[model samples]
Target: MSDQIILTTSSHLEGYRVTEHLDIVSAECVFGMNVFKDMFAGIRDIFGGRNKSSQNALRDARTSCLEELRKEAREKGANAVIGVDLDYSEISGGGKSMLFLVATGTAVKVEKV
Candidate 1:
């Protein structure tokens, strides 16, 4: 991670001004749930309990997606990313359940006010 790179969900960062607009950047991650975990999750869902396995998988995917977004922003010479958004979806095909996570933001150069 680049120390200079700032990420925020807001459209603007406090105490900093956007000096240049680079481009829109995005990163995506996909992971699958194993059969055992899927079975456990299904049971948990039926019983109406929190699915720790599913939650952990989502957390890991989100982390990876954010890291990729940071790398992209740094490569584009962006000091900050604003207006960030995250999306999560389930992709099931061929009897396999997969999770997809995507992070997106506008890369920009910001100067401290």
Candidate 2:
């Protein structure tokens, strides 16, 4: 697993075993500009209130990140991803926000194992 496969088929599992033995790789990956957004988010928070802009920004970023992961998985010939995880962080000094949508799973050709 290369930490960039978006699973969309399996509900009980993150990955679907299609082959006996094979390694999954992340062929493509995409992410949103988090640093800049985080900074602004922090500023908004300091005002003793929540900023809807910041919330919206994070949501958009997450969506974009996931889309990228799915595309990468498709390119790698993976039907689903396992052990999917999402990580978010703020830049130092609250300068920006970073969203990392990572997915990991085994890629294999389907057959009787």
Candidate 3:
């Protein structure tokens, strides 16, 4: 633990949580399943209609990725994860889609004698 950390004095949360803005100190990873979703999207595009299946799959992927990030944060001894950001994209030339979830915040350890 560093002296600059405010929460270091108290034996409470390891770090502060800011839902509106997640701090940037660590890495951001992604997890998603879009192989089948993309295929449906392409089919819907040809018919000029909405691709509900693809959209739902993307949403599911985003949720799953976020959960994974939360678990990682917990393992890293983080009290809470803030400033979470999510994104979805379709890879070019590959019939695959990607769901990215970014969770960022400070990881701190309590100072003890």
Using lDDT as the measure, the top candidate is 1
lDDT of 2 by residue, 27-110 (tens): 223344654456575664545566666667667776776676567666666655444456665333365433444444454434
Q: Write the per-residue lDDT of candidate 1 for residues 1-113, one digit (tens) a residue.
A: 34768999999999999999999999988877574366575664544566666666677788889999999999999989999999988888898887778899999999889
Off by over 4 Å in 2: 1-11, 14-49, 93-113
> TM-score of the candidate numbered 2?
0.49
Instruction: Give per-residue CA lDDT, model 3, range 12-81, as digits (tens).
Output: 4434433322233333555445455556656745444656666666576655665665556556655444
The collision pairs in model 3 are 22-82, 22-83
Which 10 consecutive positions of candidate 3 have the poorest summed lDDT?
2-11
Sliding window of 10 residues with minimal summed lDDT for model 1: 39-48
Q: Model 1 off-target regions past 4 Å?
A: 35-48
**Model 2 — which ten-residue stretch has the worst lDDT?**
20-29
The Cα local distance difference test for each model comes to 0.84, 0.51, 0.47
TM-score of 1: 0.83
Clashing residue pairs for model 1: none
